[model samples]
Target: MSEPGSDHDAPQAGREPIFMLPPVVTALAGIMLAIHLATTLVLDNVGLYQLTLWFGFIPMRLLAPDQLPGGFWPLLWTPFSHAFLHANWEHVIFNTLWLAIFATPVARRYGALPTLVIFLVTSAAGALAFAATTLPNVQVLIGASGGVAGLTGAAMRFIFQPVMVGTDPDTGQRVLLGRHLASLREVFTNPRSRNFSLIWIVLNAAVPLVPALIGQDIQIAWQAHLGGFVIGLLLPPLFERSWQHE
Candidate 1:
């Protein structure tokens, strides 16, 4: 039987096995960082403002689609496009770092095309979830947090298993997916998985309250994080066939 992540699980009988970041994963992270720099450093305040207005996911627009500036057509792109933009250097940097960790495994297992698909779908799902919970004219949601959260969810599919030095009966050596991959029950029952889930939930749950303690009026898109994470957790199984061959 084929195991998930088998493609990257073991090295072939080659001269040497070199470990490195897959090119596509690196490229995706590079593109996000490059865009952040270009928008923050190169673009003028007015230019950057305009881009945000155009690209940012505004829940109000969904309520009043006819009132959107530059026509309602921009709505078509904003859902996924907003992920490519960030509010500040810290926001972009943090998300990019997470992407490197989670997306690398996915890209290695499923290839570049599927990784891109995951980014788009999770980004949009997160935005939609944010819109669903928020009232109109609240605030615009920006950043790759949702997409990265989705990646985190995807990684949870098999990354938490016990590791082995050599081939073990339960899980082979260096195999993240393990012998049979994890069922939802195995995932939730595992201590590491349970703790991570709790921590993630608490962190997102506290997003709105955290800003208040600092006397800031920021609206954190916690809804998006939850949405993306749920999608990530559930999406991997459906796409299992794509990576099973690896």
Candidate 2:
């Protein structure tokens, strides 16, 4: 039954499937796995360390430009490159799962090309955000969490609302038959969105504490997550407003 006064009460009725995994997403995730295997399993320790040093986002390198082997050029690429690197298998698995969950909808909406752009921008933004919080040389950021977090943010734009499809009155073609884009005010005002955001923020912020409690030495890059999420949230309005009527 429809929840009280929910507009999305109408059951989904259309030829277009609501959700499906795009090959792009699967291929991207597979590439990440392949890279992990190549770096960790195929390469020797020295090679892996070299790869990490070259690709990982080292705050120290940015903070101390003179110390950088190739100078500022590496800084330009490290932000996005770091997304393809993970510290361990657990890290890659965690990030890949989240990527699958959040990125699928976005890739569906924007297709592969724009989705790739989103990944790069959010990944870089996350790295930059993390770097801002820490002192130079303190940590080398690596992982797809930032990019995945961005996808999560983008999905929030329309995923929660019910989407309807129908023929356009003028064009006689299928058009957006769903709720309009949620305004910024609406996003904050809506209980579901507000609560989800709150829970997500709190959980990520609390991750660092989990290691301490569990007696593990692993570091959680919560800073990167927050940064990427923020980028994801903001990016859609600019690029995806057009898709609202699609």
Question: Per-residue alpha-carbon lDDT of model 1 for 97-139, expressed as tens digits?
Answer: 8898998877766778877878888999999999888876557
Q: Which stretches of candidate 1 lie over 4 Å from their true place?
A: 1-19, 162-179, 212-214
lDDT values, one for every candidate: 0.80, 0.81
Relative to the true structure, candidate 2 reaches a TM of: 0.82
Task: Report the CA-based lDDT of candidate 2 relative to the real structure.
Answer: 0.81
lDDT of 2 by residue, 109-188 (tens): 87787788888899998898888888754688999999899888877777776667779789999876654456656666
